[model samples]
Target: MTDFITRFAPSPTGPLHLGHAYSAMLCHDMARTAQGRFLLRMEDTDLQRSKPEWDALIREDLTWLGLHWDAPVLRQSEQISSYDLYLDQLAEHDLLYPCSCSRADIRAALSAPQEGHPHEVYPGTCKARPISDRNQGDALRLHLDRALVMLADDLPSFQETGGTHKGTHQIDPDQAQEQIGDVVLTRKGERMIAYFLASAIDDATQGITHVIRGEDLFDFTAIQVILLTLLNLSVPTYHHHRLIRDENGKRLAKRDDARAISTYRNDGRTPSDIRRMVGL
Candidate 1:
């Protein structure tokens, strides 16, 4: 069997919470079971919000949860040049286009309701515009329709090991247009890299074999697969596990500090207790 490599990447915008613990422990156990490797990554591309204290606390929380990684943590902020390189590759293929549309601009352009969210789909207003006309302050977006045509001869498929959706699947064109529209690869503000572009590139660079993440991200896997295929990177198996939610049946967010791992640690909860809480 090929070597198994997995990662638990978290943005250090806030303290690690129960949801973070659940995802981390799942990846850690999966790697251990395969006798392979597990990695930790600080997805701190959002420079404005990410904090040094949160980074240190995240490490402490992972250690407290009895989880271990095989490599020194990979920080996304340190790898800006790598993302630029991939962007250049896309540009060479004519798969990327500059977009100056802000959130308000996109919302106003959408004439119909989108599948998940209207804002999720880009109206493609700037797609036909010349690349030379794009300003330095504009964001970059993937020309999804053209990208699919570029890979029409050999689109990719991925294995999903997560319980909700198991087995291999292919990207469908109809769903791609409705659900996975032209996604922004770079932001206009201080944070230049988007989650899809950054995480997809990091997974390939880190040699992540199994993308063990939450089911909430299950719908977005197709975009990453497409990005990896376009960049000529190996696509990894995906295992999007169930999310850990609160008593109200709401998935926990970083804002839910009451459910933060640090709060539980301070409350005298043990590592074993966390495992039981998340149903390991």
Candidate 2:
């Protein structure tokens, strides 16, 4: 069997837009071309927003696009306990701490600029909070300083096979510390793991060899790589393909129902039409 395993993981919180179709078709085509496996994963970890109807609709849209995945599709909602184990592993290293800061709090901190302080990144409002103080409703954030110190001599890096930044890139501690800061791993009281952490863990667990997704996520790859390296998991090659944007050049979001795959299909567009529209 080929080792070029990949996945098209999408949250079932909204309709499957054209952007989703492009990404799914790209992954499907790549795996088929390599005679490898293309898997489907429902990132339904957002318990509040995730719905069974949306999940069904997403699968239906993908199937209608003539795309197919292997048996036993994985769902993130069912893997919470497994993710909790990973979080515990990080906690064992003292890399995680409780964060009670809300988005508004973070925004206010960033807006009120302090000298030599990074504006866009988290200001470490709860960095001093110990893990032992973690309550039922507090979010968990990775202490990048300690995590980087743990891997001082061996910072994680990955090879990019696609996108404008095509090359072997290493994680720069300074950029990660200043720009990315201490990122939350779990939401407040939700028990929902962050996208980067869960996706990284899932990629390793599923034996994914290549991560094919939009270039918008390229910047966040380093943090994921760091997590994988910390857990001693295999890091996958990433291909951040160009996004399929609308006529106004805005990248498609779930709310863009007019550009949804189902809408196009309902308008009498065929699978070939989709491939052509996406320039595949």
Candidate 3:
């Protein structure tokens, strides 16, 4: 049997709030229950916002919460070359194209009201651009239509153990083409990769069997699964747990310093108190 390996990946852009505490503690408890490995990863691909001090503070807060992760923590910043290799493979398949469209440009092109659409789907302005035409500051977007056709024989799907949309769910080609058209895999300047791409590659490379995260990210799981299938990597089971919200019923953000774990610790809150607060 494969070991139940899970990970708690957090961006070092801000302080660890109650929301982060809930996710980390949940992952830690589950790993311990299964007697499996719980790994820590720093999702610091956004180099502009990611800071060394915040990274140190994150480790400190996790330790203070009595949540220990298996060592040596993985940092996405160190895996740029690895991510590039995967991008290269996707490029070779002719499934990626350079996109130089800015937000204003996209909005201008999409002037027609896209009512009932939850997200602003890219209009694929650069879909016809060849890979050879990629510039230094251009972003790379996936040709979802072409990729789906490539996987026409066997579409990508995943198993969800938790969340509102639990059970087996398959990626519908029609819905994907409409809702998730030509999603960006690499940001402009090509210095950073998209979260979907990086996380998908990391989960596969680390051999994570179970992905435990917040329910808010559940919607984006399909794109990750698609990328995994395209890369011929193993897809892990997903468990999207409920988020820890503030008293106002709003989801806690990094700016919510009052609900930060560090604040609670400084106010003399115990780990057990935290577990109770998060309904663990």
Cα error, candidate 1, residue 222 (Å): 0.3
Cα RMSD for predicted model 1: 3.6
Per-residue C-alpha lDDT of model 1 across residues 19-125, encoded as one tens digit per residue: 88999998999899999899999988767678999999999999988888888999988887678888889888887777887755532322112223434577778
Write one digit per residue (lDDT tens) for candidate 2, span 158-239. Answer: 9999978899999999999877888778855656677778888999999999999988778778888999999999999999
Screening candidate 1 with a backbone cut-off below 3 angstroms (N, C-alpha, C), the clashing residue pairs are none
Give the Å shift of residue 133 in candidate 3. 1.0
Q: Rate the local accuracy (lDDT) of all candidates.
A: 0.83, 0.85, 0.85
- Candidate 1 minimal-lDDT segment of 10 residues: 106-115
lDDT of 1 at 276: 94
Model 3, position 8, has a per-residue lDDT of 97
